[model samples]
Target: MSIPTGDVPIGATVLALAEGATLTPVWANEIGGFTFRAQRADGTTRYIKYGPHNAEVSMFDEAERLSWANQYLRVPVVVQVGADHTHEWLVTEAIDGASAVDPRWIAEPRTAVTAIGRGLRRLHDALPVSECAWLWDPYSRIAGAEARGLTVPDRLRTPPSDDVLVVCHGDACAPNTLLDDAGNPIAHVDFGALGLGDRWSDIAVASMSTEWNYGPGYEDLLIEAYGVEPDRDRLAYYRDLWNAT
Candidate 1:
C-alpha cells in the first residue's frame, strides 16, 4: 500500500536493481528516496528502497541494523543491498501488514493508536539493551546531530536520565508500525536509526507522531495502551530532542 506523493518521478533505473522482478513505484520521501514494491514471476513480493548517497540516508547502515535487530523483533528481512557512486539501495522481504497510518487505520484512530503504543512497548520489552551493539544515548545522539551540521538547542541537549533504558526503535512514528487488517500491529519497519536508548526516546516520538499522522486527542490512548503513566519531563525533553536531532 503506497501513498502517492508527487515529488519524484514514478520510475527509475534503481527499480531494475533486482533481476527478474517488475517494480511498481509506491512511495517517495522528502530525502529524495523512493520505495518500490516488486513482484517476481514466482509470486514473491519484495520492497526496494533507493536514495542518493549524499542524502545521508544509508540503506547499507539500515541493512546492517536490520540484520542485528531481526534476532529479537519482527521486522523486514534483508534480501540484498547494492550501491553505486551516486546512490544506494536496499531490497527487503515484505512484512505481513500495512503501515499503521494506512487509510483504513487513519479513519480508526483508536485502534491504530492503541496498536502503535502496544507494538512499541512489545518492541522495547522484547529487545534487551544489554545485547544490542549500537548506542542511542544522549551523548551519542547529540554528537550525531552535530555531525549532521545541525545545532542542538540547550534545552534539548540534556536528556531526562538513563535510569531506565530500552532498545529504542529510533524512528517510532505511527507510520513505521505495520498493522494487520484487524488493526492489530503485526510488525515494525524502518530501523535505520535503531539503538539502545531511554524508553522515552521511543515513547515520546511514538506519541507525538500520533498527532502528526492521526488527528488530535489520541496521545493519551497510546500511553494507556502502553500501560504506563505519563512522564511529562521525559516526554517534553525527548520530543524536543526528536525534533532537534
Candidate 2:
C-alpha cells in the first residue's frame, strides 16, 4: 500500500522504512526531524516522526515514553516504531486539535496561556510520581550535560528548594500543548523529553516560553490559572537550567 514515491522530503524515507504508508510533511522541529500525516486504508489519520541519525533527541525514546504515558494520560497511541541504519521513526494516531501557539491563539494570549496552565496541572496530577520510571532531576540532567562535554553554569548547578514534586512534562513549551478552537486543551504532544522532575522544571520553561512565543506579561496569567502563587526562586533557577542544559 505504499504510495508512489515522489519528491517528498523525509516522507519518502519513512515511507520506505515503514511499509503501506504514503505521508506528507506536516511539521518540522528545531532538531532535524520531520512529522508527517498519513491517511490509511481504514480512514484513520496517523502521524509519523523521523529523527535524523545524528540528532540529539531520540524518536524511539519518545515513542516508548508515549506508550508508557498512554496508560495514564491522553498521548498518541503508537502504531509502529522502527529504525533503519541511519534514522529512527515512530508512527502514531494523530491527536486532535491545533497547538496552543497557533496564530489564532497567539492573538488571544490570555485564553491560550491560561489553558496551558490548567492543562499542565492536569498532567502533573494525572501521572503518579511513585509509578514513574524516569528522572529528569538536576542530578541526572547535570550528568547528561557533562557527558556531552558541556558544563552547567555555576548558578544552575544548584536548584532552588522544590516547591512540590509532581510528574513534569520535561519540555513544557506552549506549543507542546494542543488546544481546540474553544481554547480548551485536548492533548499534549512532543513527549521526547518526558520524565519525572521538579514541577518547576516544566513551569519555568513554560513561563519563559510565553515571552519567546507571545512576548512578556502572560507568564503570571499562566501562574494564576495553575492555582498557585509563583515560586519566584524556583522559577529563576529552572529557567537558568533550561538554558544551561
What ranges in model 1 sit over 4 Å off? 6-12, 54-57
Q: Give the residue spans of candidate 2 off by over 4 A.
A: 1-8, 17-22, 54-56
Candidate 1 lowest-lDDT run of ten:
1-10
Q: RMSD in angstroms, all models?
A: 2.0, 4.2
lDDT of 1: 0.84
Error of 1 at 115 (Å): 0.4
Model 2 C-alpha RMSD vs. true structure (Å) is 4.2
Angstrom error of the Cα, residue 136, model 2: value is 1.0
> lDDT per prediction?
0.84, 0.81
The alpha-carbon deviation from the true structure for residue 20 of candidate 1, after best TM-score superposition, in angstroms, is 4.2
**Residue-wise lDDT of candidate 2 within 1-245, one digit each (tens)?**
02224454654667664457556776776555677777666777888877766433577778778888899989889888878887788888887788898889989999999999999989998888998887888878888878878888877776776778887888899988999889998789888778889888988888888888899899998888877889898898888887887
User: Candidate 1, residues 124-240: lDDT per residue as tens digits?
Assistant: 888887888888777888888888899999877666777478888898989899998988888899888889898888888899989888979998889889879989888888888
